[model samples]
Target: MDRPEKLLTTAQAAEHLGISRGTLARYARDGLLKPTLKLPTGHLRWSLEDLRRQMRELREQGGE
Candidate 1:
């Protein structure tokens, strides 16, 4: 069976993506990356799978 997806807070997601929190927020604003969840307190969360997929796509497109 497949494992459940891991959820990451904005800071953790940014760190995993090798980017700053501000940049991650910009990407979300630009629709480059969508948050998996937004808590009632207004915090963003991202799925590890989604981040990994984006990284793979970026690599395929010759982006760092």
Candidate 2:
């Protein structure tokens, strides 16, 4: 059996990615990123692993 992955809140994810919460939300809105989970109440959650991958991609792209 595999353990469940712990998802992070928007603010936490933003901090980990070294970006503002607004920028993180904007990235999600613009389709540059997507929340790993969204509750029925509209709360968003992100995967830290995904954020790291995003950071790597951004660095590779020179943040263009």
Candidate 3:
């Protein structure tokens, strides 16, 4: 299978970071997480690298 190059949906990104969708949504709202693409269906998409960066930041902050 071919790997996707970029952009993950909220669910995928959350799963990768081992977080709930609600938490991801809140991060997005707080501007801690930014979307690379906003689909017509109102779904937010984030780059894999960006998601990983956010996860790293969260880990550093130790809020969980």
Candidate 4:
């Protein structure tokens, strides 16, 4: 079986989600989404699957 894709950086996650990097940071602050990991450099990363799930949930909730 193919291995799952690795976690993505804030920029990659933002682009994949079709949102701005600041928006992603805002979401993180608002507790709408959480990072999968925090690097030693203090950068945040997220799993593609988790990002997708958050998008779906937002859509279902009528995007607030």
Error of 3 at 34 (Å): 0.7
Indicate the worst ten consecutive residues by lDDT in candidate 2: 55-64
Model 1: how far is 15 from its true place, Å?
A: 0.6
Deviation of model 1 at 35, angstroms: 1.2
Clash tally, candidates in order:
0, 0, 0, 0
Please, what are the lDDT tens digits per residue for candidate 1 over residues 1-64?
A: 9988889998999998788999888877777777899889989999978877876786798865
Least well predicted 10-residue stretch by lDDT in candidate 4: 55-64
* Residue pairs clashing, model 1: none
lDDT of 4: 0.87
lDDT for each candidate structure: 0.83, 0.84, 0.81, 0.87
Model 3 per-residue lDDT tens digits across residues 14-63: 89878898888898888777778888998899887977876778779884
Candidate 4, 1-64: lDDT as tens digits: 9997799998999999889998998888787887898889978899989888987898798874
Give the clashing residue pairs of candidate 4, or none. none
Q: Against the true structure, what is each candidate's TM-score? A: 0.72, 0.76, 0.70, 0.78
Ranking by TM-score: 4, 2, 1, 3
| Best model number under TM-score | 4
Question: Which scores greater on TM-score, model 1 or model 4?
Answer: 4
Q: Give the range of the ten consecutive residues with the poorest summed lDDT in model 1.
A: 55-64
Give the runs in model 1 whose Cα sits over 4 Å from its true position: 1-3, 58-64
- Supply candidate 4's per-residue lDDT for 57: 92
